[model samples]
Target: MADRWYPMGVPSFSRLAHEVPEPGMLVAHDRALYRVIVVHEDHPANWAEKDRNRLVQNRRAVEERKRHRARPLPREVFYPSPLDGWDGSEETWPNRPRGVELQPMAGGKRLHAGWPHPGWAYWYPVDEHHPVCASCGEPFPCREVDAAKEAARQMVKVEKLMAVGPSCCWHCGEPITSRQGARTFPGENLLLPGGPSPSFHQRKTGGCLYAAKEYEKKWREANPDLAETADLFGPADA
Candidate 1:
């Protein structure tokens, strides 16, 4: 059976950039100037739940843009404390691994792949011993088991931190400090250096929200052509 289409689902950005537009296709309502990357007729979601997630993410992006515009820029005097150790530089902080590149198999099927979550170890019982490698699926001796487990733990931690996305100071593009493998910044409600983190809602607003708003204004001014369409208008219905 073929997949069904819906309006407002997240369109693939990469595809949109490369492909030429076809006739009879409608430009995305969220931002009319930008054409839809993947037509709903072609890249439909597998289920309503997937559709809902895309809708929510797109909505959040709009809200964030609004908040970004309304908020003020970071003040020149505002240097995140040295004690906090987040210098706010992008050169120092790198984007996380792209994870597994997923594509549909058929009928809008999702492929199960991507970087594993960082908190995998916290879920495993350290006291109990398993001989088989959970990640690589290789057999190791009891002595090697701990080593493999530690390696697994390390990969998760590293990927998680990298997952936080670019490490530049959200304000000045200064390199940020990732102390003890923890990606720390000096602001609140801060759009994470990456997408939402596992501990997202739990994070205190720490003034990052204000910093983001300021940063948005600076960026928009720098790039006058980048339309603030979605920022001004909420995501639209089909």
Candidate 2:
């Protein structure tokens, strides 16, 4: 597929191969002989398990013989969101009404609710100045004042969501939205454990947002009572 080519000066390669620069054409490489352009594979040498095993086996010999080293995986590779803590058994979110249930956004889509760093909305400070419409209290179709108030309310919800003690990205204030969006820890920070280590006890890296979901998956996989939970929480409206 990549073998096709277009000339630099002329639009077509076939015509440019022989055309000379008079008013338009320019003579380039000779067209009499065929030249082969080799394309090598760009996959990393240690991409596969077998390649990794071979590399490990040859490590001592390679080091002793001073052979070139294979490139290592980038230290800054993205990590998935860490799992949520408490299994939905405890109340951690603050300034929330009782029995308020906020479902995680769809497509593993992380909402911009602020993580460790304060966001533009934070400086604005949502309050009564931006009150919900007296006519309608629901989220949308409100004035700028109401929108800012809603953003504040949502930010509160987000804080409550994370107060359960989930590990969050430093840049974004919300839960690590996408594992692919996560960056490497820049330095020692509050989110890490004992310095550079991840907080695994409270959260599982790359796991679901709610611990209840994980529990349900495991329970259903092991037991035959998956159908019985229909009356418990019912289907997610998400």
Candidate 3:
């Protein structure tokens, strides 16, 4: 005789009549594979009980999901501090600004508490009237400091440009004459000595073009700082 199959009772298929097979019969239903220990009458009461248990399981699953779902933290909570492991003592944080205190937070985490905010280690106001920069925690309108920083950056760039040797063909290492056809690198005005572009190949001969290209590739690999600046300026014209 051919093997027969029967589905177990579930809430969706409860209305369908299910026939109970003999004991030790193999049953596969709802992803569950089991052998029947004993045969029982297929009754509506048994299906109703199973349905009640399934409903309870579904309610429990929903509640579990809700419990684990992330919710917005309060403004006071801010975010995890870099000093999360620091002990709640001023001596530990010697650099901790005046009026800031080490405050104990939830989950045994400690944070640097400043006026009007918590959990931010660097944020503090100069006074009640002046707002602070979110990053540096300095007073607003820090133009002087910003200008000084920019000047310093420019000075570094100038120094790097000055470090590059005089205008010459990268391939030949020969000094580029004024009469030669030249290709200008990015920031050539600052980079080349006396403000002249490097001569790669003479337009008449074009002999050094391929070698210049290969040499430039290696040069760019060696000088990453100038390579980034070169990318910003894009390909130079002949």
Candidate 4:
């Protein structure tokens, strides 16, 4: 009874009112509400044919749907792994070994399974949506991800990770560890003279070493009173 449904197809108000004679079955016709109504007779200006032919079949479908158990759907994981590229596929992970079959996600890009991705992984209808970067947490066409990629490339160029160790400057012969070490001298000279450099100092007293050494050299030449044996790293009074 409660689960029962009315007829399908177009509703004939006249036929229904005549057969059932329900109290609230009255329908408006020509500005006057009547128990029975006619179809296509008034030529109502607002009502469309599709809407006018109203039908509600199998109200049981709603009740059945409420009681019906749903089929188990596959689990969806968002945000593909950042290390998928670096770590090889041989290593088993959650939902890995047997990778969850992806059906062309929201954007063209799906979850990053691993290196050597199949054609199907990238298969998706063309759309305006762009893929999101896992590391930066920004969508594609993101300037931050672009900058990060560039920084990685620069790091490779500066460090030469595959090489033995930190590279020494070809001209200066000094160990170049960081990117800043590659800078040239004040004179724009790539190489410093093998003899002496200003940055290095010889003295250990109150005055700066380079300055003290320069002063000592100048004082020795000018005063000529102090012996050349005054010493470089000894007490200032000496």
Backbone atom clashes (below 3 Å) for every candidate = 19, 9, 0, 0
lDDT of each: 0.33, 0.31, 0.41, 0.31
Which portions of model 1 show Cα errors greater than 4 Å? Answer: 1-42, 70-238
Name the runs in model 3 displaced over 4 angstroms. Answer: 1-141, 166-194, 198-238
| Better model by lDDT: candidate 1 vs candidate 4 | 1
Query: Can you give the TM-score per candidate against the true fold?
Result: 0.17, 0.15, 0.22, 0.16
Candidate 4's residue-wise lDDT over 117-151, tens digit each?
23222222222333444665333424454456568
Q: How do these models rank on lDDT, best leading? A: 3, 1, 4, 2
Lowest summed-lDDT stretch of 10 residues in model 1? 119-128
What is residue 40's positional error in candidate 4, in angstroms? Answer: 45
lDDT value for candidate 2?
0.31
lDDT of 1 by residue, 7-110 (tens): 22222232222222332332321111121223222122233454446445545554564566654347513632111222323222111111222232122543
Give the least accurate 10-residue stretch of model 2, judged by summed lDDT: 93-102
TM-score of model 2 (CA atoms): 0.15
Q: Judged by lDDT, which candidate is best?
A: 3
lDDT of 4 at 34: 28
- What's the C-alpha lDDT at position 206 in model 3? 44
| Minimal lDDT window, size 10, model 3 | 1-10
- At residue 28, what lDDT does model 2 achieve? 20
Tens-digit lDDT track of model 3 for 55-148:
4554554455457854533641664332334443333421232222232211243223222122222221112243434666434323444556
Model 4 scores worst on lDDT over the 10 consecutive residues at 1-10
Evaluate residue 65 in candidate 4 and report its C-alpha lDDT on the 0 to 100 scale.
Answer: 39
Candidate scoring better on lDDT of 1 and 3:
3
Who is ahead in TM-score, 1 or 3?
3
Q: Which regions of candidate 4 fall more than 4 Å away from where they truly are? A: 1-126, 133-141, 161-186, 189-238
